[model samples]
Target: MGSTLVQRRLSSALAIMTFAVLLTGCGTWWHGDHQSVTIFTTPPDAAVVVDERVHLLAPGTVSLNRKGNHHAVATKDGYESAVMTLSRTWSWWLLGDVFGCLIVFSPFCIMHDIDEGGYYTFDDTIYITLDRKSAAWAPVK
Candidate 1:
């Protein structure tokens, strides 16, 4: 009876350990590599340029890779252009990667999340304010 009880406990512990290891880098699986970010301007409609490449009209949404920070510029005919940076920060979901890898004694387990850009996140919505240029220099729109 004593041996049987020990075997059961060992089995339970092994099962739990296996489950935790299997969940390593859960953030990579759950969050993926891309996220949608919405941009809204104070004056509503304006042209937005991202990374000096993708062009989107403000009051819009764009899908961005989570691997790095981004730069955005918003311009209107009469308002001074607004520049903003979209920065990436550690995501709470990465805690799963941290804990799971620690349990397995493998730092490599967390690499999956980091390499896949799942360890970071961006703000879902961003608001930008545009200042109107002086009447003398403002473009007539």
Candidate 2:
């Protein structure tokens, strides 16, 4: 009976440790709100403005929240400033989060996105073209 009790306790301890590991993502660390994204321009060196507030240079990386729609605008000298929106769509991996339910405090699997070191790259490379607004000759006033 003593031997049997020892085995049972060992099993229970193992299970609890496993549960804790899962909750911690097995060493995966991440911030709940911070996600990474990369922005690039065709010509590069364009001033990239994000959310109309944060400014960055093209071919650069930026961190953004995963909660809402994010916007980026690229402007280069003599080029028509271009705008693009980066919205957080549903991540398919969230479907696999069902197993995460077993671990308390680990809803990460079911979360909206996968934060692999916040290295999400923009899907499309922004392209900007130079714009020269044509002026029409007018009569002297």
Candidate 3:
């Protein structure tokens, strides 16, 4: 009787462990299906413009899980807008390449800065006010 009770308890514990493992595995599988978008700009410190408006200034990366078409524009206050298109697919590819290069050449890239004193010299203090539509994120239904 005692041995039978112990066996039953062990079996129950094993079943619970198996269920936990299965649940964890399923969660991981579901997570793998999630998609994301990444944004990258040429100058690490350039402002980011979405659509035609400036969203955030300067070199940074942003991620989004939702799907839709997004236009990204990068600009520094004194510089021109560096416009780019981002779809789910394009964003991933472009960002991956950008990050990979950044990682591989970080030291070298960090040594360089946008020349602020050349013929292209524009007012470093000038801040470009981006139009509203360009900076807003609109979800496509």
Taken over the whole model, the C-alpha lDDT of each candidate is 0.88, 0.60, 0.41
Tens-place lDDT per residue, model 2, 21-125, is 454432123434555677878667889889988898878887777556688888887667787778665443333344444545466644433554221223433
Q: Cα miss at 136, model 2 (Å)?
A: 8.7
Q: Estimate the overall C-alpha local distance difference test score of candidate 2.
A: 0.60
Clashes of each: 0, 0, 12
How would you encode candidate 3's per-residue C-alpha lDDT over 1-141 as one tens digit per residue? Answer: 999999999999788655443332232133222333334444456667666653764433344322344567666655556556554332122232234334353332212111111111111122223322344587999
Better of 1 and 3 by TM-score: 1
TM-score of 3: 0.33
TM-score, candidate 2, is 0.56
Which clashing pairs does model 1 show? none
Clashes of 2: 0
Question: Which run of 10 residues does model 1 get worst, by summed lDDT?
Answer: 100-109
On TM-score, the stronger of 2 and 3 is 2
- What's the lDDT for candidate 3? 0.41
